[model samples]
Target: MISEPFANKKTWVHSLDPRLRVCTAFFLSCLFAITNQPVLAACALIASALLLGCSRPPLSALLRRLAGVNLFILFLWCSVPFFTPGTPIAKFGPLTCTQEGLDLVWLVTLKANAITLLLIACIGTMSASLLGHALQALRLPDKFVYLLLFTYRSLFVLADEWQRLQTALRLRGFVAGTNLHTYRTVGYLFGLTLTRSLDRAQRIHQAMLLRGFTGRFPAFVLLRFQRHDFLFAILTALFLIFLLFFWNNPFFP
Candidate 1:
C-alpha cells in the first residue's frame, strides 16, 4: 500500500544512462544473494534504505504505502524452515524445523527483499519511457518491447475508467452485502471491466496499425553517460564485493 515515489521529478539517478541504472540494480541483487549472514545482509539492507532516503522522499510516505507489501516480504521467510531441515533450534509445540532451515529463511528473505527495494528504487528514479528506450537499445526483441510499452500505456487508461465506474457505483448507493447479491455484484464488475478492457485494446491496436506500426517500437536514445558513470558503477561493485565477502564461504558446510 506504499505510495509510489517513483513518480518524482527528475533527479541525479534519473539523469544517468538507463544502462547504468539497470546494471546497478542487477549488481545489488547479486550482492544480496551472495551474502547470507543476517548481520551482514542487514547492513546491506540498511545501505539500500539510505539510498532510498537520499532519493528525497519522506520516510512516512514509504511506510504508510509500502509497509503492507513489506510485511508480506517478511512472511516470505516462513517458507524456508518448512522445506529445509537439519538440526533443531526451536520446537513450536511439536514441529522439528531446524536452525539451518531458519538460517536459509533469513538468507532468502533478506536477499529477495533487498533486491525488491533496489528494483523499486530504480523504478522510482527512472521514467518508464527511459526504461523502454534502454531495453530497446539493448536489442531486445521488438515485439516483446512494444507489447510491454503498449501494455503499460493501457493501464493508466483502464485505471481511470475503473475510477469512474467506482464513482458511478458509489453515487447510485450500490453496496455489497453478505449474500448471493454480493457474488452477483462482483461478477458484474468483473464482466464489465473485462469487456471494457478488451474493447479498448482492440481500438488501440487498430489505431497503432493505422499509424504504420510494423511490429516495431521506435527507439530514441535520450542521453549518454560520462566518466562519473563508471565511478558510480565501480562503487556499486565494491559494495557488492563487501557484502558477499562478509560471510565465510560455506558451500562445503
Candidate 2:
C-alpha cells in the first residue's frame, strides 16, 4: 500500500476498479472543459471534493501536493485584474479592473482547481503500475506505454537521488534562498539530475534486454468488468448527457 494520502486502502475510491476512476476523471474533465458557468463549475468542484473526502486521502497530503501549483494560481489571480482590460468596475489610472475580467478570473481559477482535484482523485488512489496496466488493456500505443512505464519508474528513482542531493546541499550550508550563486547551483543540480536520469534509463534498458526484454512489453492483466463498473458507466453516460444538454440550455447561465 502507498503510505501517502492517495495510497490509502480504506476509501471507496481505493476499492474502485482503476478503469472506473480513469473514465470518471476523464468524463468530468471533458465536462469541465466545455462548460463555462460558475454555478455549474461549482457543482463539478463539489463532486470532486466529495471524491477526495470519500477517498480518505490525507488533507495535508493534498495540500502539500497542490501547494506549488496553488501558489502559481494565486499569482495568476492577482495579475488578471490589472492586465485584463474591460469596462471599469474599478479604476486606478491605467489599471481599470472590469467585472468581466474578475468573473473570468474566478471562472478559470475554480475550473483549474477542480481539474487538479479530479486528477489527484484518480492518480492518488492508483499505483503507476496499475495505470500502465490500464493503458495497455485500453489498447494505448505499446511504444508510448513502455515509454511511460520506464519514465514512471525513473521518476521515483531520481526523486530519491534528488533528496540526497538536497540534503548534501543543506549540510554544506547551501541555503535554498534566491541568489545568483544559489540559482547557478540549482541549475547545475538540474543538469546533473537529467544526466543521471539518462544514465539510469540506459542501465534499465540494458537490464531489461538481458532479461529477454522484447520489442513489446508483456500484456497487462485484465480487470474483470464487474456489475459496479457497468452501473457506473451507465450512470456516467446519463449524467454526461444531462450535463451537456443543460450546458446548451438557455436557462443554464
Candidate 3:
C-alpha cells in the first residue's frame, strides 16, 4: 500500500514528468553525497522537507517511514562516534566521543534525511512501472531497469506468501517463543517458504513465456513532458546549483 501511494496522489510533484523528476533526484542525490559541510548538509535536509511538503503525502505515514529510517541512523550515531578519532568531547567510562565523530554523526544523519526526503518527493510520487520506463528513457541499462521492476513486483508477492504462512501457523495452534520447538518450526517455515518461492518463480516464468514477455518490457503508457515539467526541473536545478556555489563561497572561509 505504501509502495504505490504515488498513483493515488494528484499533487504538483506527481504531475511533473517522471523523466525530469528522475534526473533531478539523481543530481540532487549526487550533490547531497558529495557535500561535506554541515551547513550545506542541513540545507540539503531542508530542501528534502520542502520537496516532501510539495508532494503532500500523508504526514503520519511520512513520519512513520522516517521513524523507521531513524532507528538505523540512531545505531550509527551511537556506534560511529566511539570509533572515530579526534578531540575528545565527552567521556563515558572508558569510551569517549571525539569532536570529529560528532561531526560525522551529524553529517550522516543530515545526508540520510535529505536523500530520503528527496526520494519520497521526487521518485516516490510516481508509479514504479512508470519510473522504470523513465529510467529506460534515460538510457539506463535495460537489465538494471528490469531488475528494479521485477524486484518491486515480487516483494508484494513474497509478503503475501509470508502472511499466508503466518496465518496457517496461527491456525495450527503455533505459539512462538524462544524455545527449541519454536526455533525448529521457524526453520521449517523458512525452508518451506524458500521452496514455495522457487516454485512460484518457475510458474511466473512459464506464465510470462505464455504471454510472450520478451526480455524487454512493453510500454504501457507514453510519457509526455509539459512546460511546467521543464520549468519545475529547471528551477530545482538552479536552486541546488545556487546552494552548491554558495557553500564554497569565501564567507564561510
TM-scores of the candidates are 0.80, 0.82, 0.89
lDDT for each residue of candidate 1 in 1-253, tens digit (9 for 90 to 100): 1234565645565566778877788777776777657777777677777766666655675665467656776665565675577888777765667878888777666666666667766665766777778778777887777777777777876786677777878898988788998788778877787788889889988998999988766666655777767777787878877765656756323
Q: Best to worst by TM-score, what's the order?
A: 3, 2, 1
Model 3 poorest 10 in a row by lDDT: 1-10
Q: Tell me, what's the RMSD of every candidate? A: 3.5, 3.5, 2.2
Q: After superposition, how far is residue 36 of candidate 1 from its true place, in Å?
A: 3.7
Over the stretch 1-253, how does candidate 3's per-residue lDDT look in tens digits?
1366645688888888889989888999998988788788888899889878977788777888799989999998889998899999899999999989989999989998999999888888888888999999999999999999888877777777777899999999999999999999999888887778778988999999999988998888788999898789778978887877887777643
The list of candidate 2 runs beyond 4 A from truth reads 1-4, 162-197, 219-221
- Clashing residue pairs in all predictions, respectively, total 4, 0, 0
**TM-score computed on alpha carbons, candidate 3:** 0.89
Error of 2 at 91 (Å): 2.5
Model 1 vs truth, CA RMSD:
3.5
Candidate 2, 1-253: lDDT as tens digits: 1244586566666766787778788878988866788877887788778767777777777888678667887887778877776777887877778877888888887788788888888766887778877777778898888888777777787886688788888899887777899899999888887888788778878998999978776646668777766776787687677677778677777
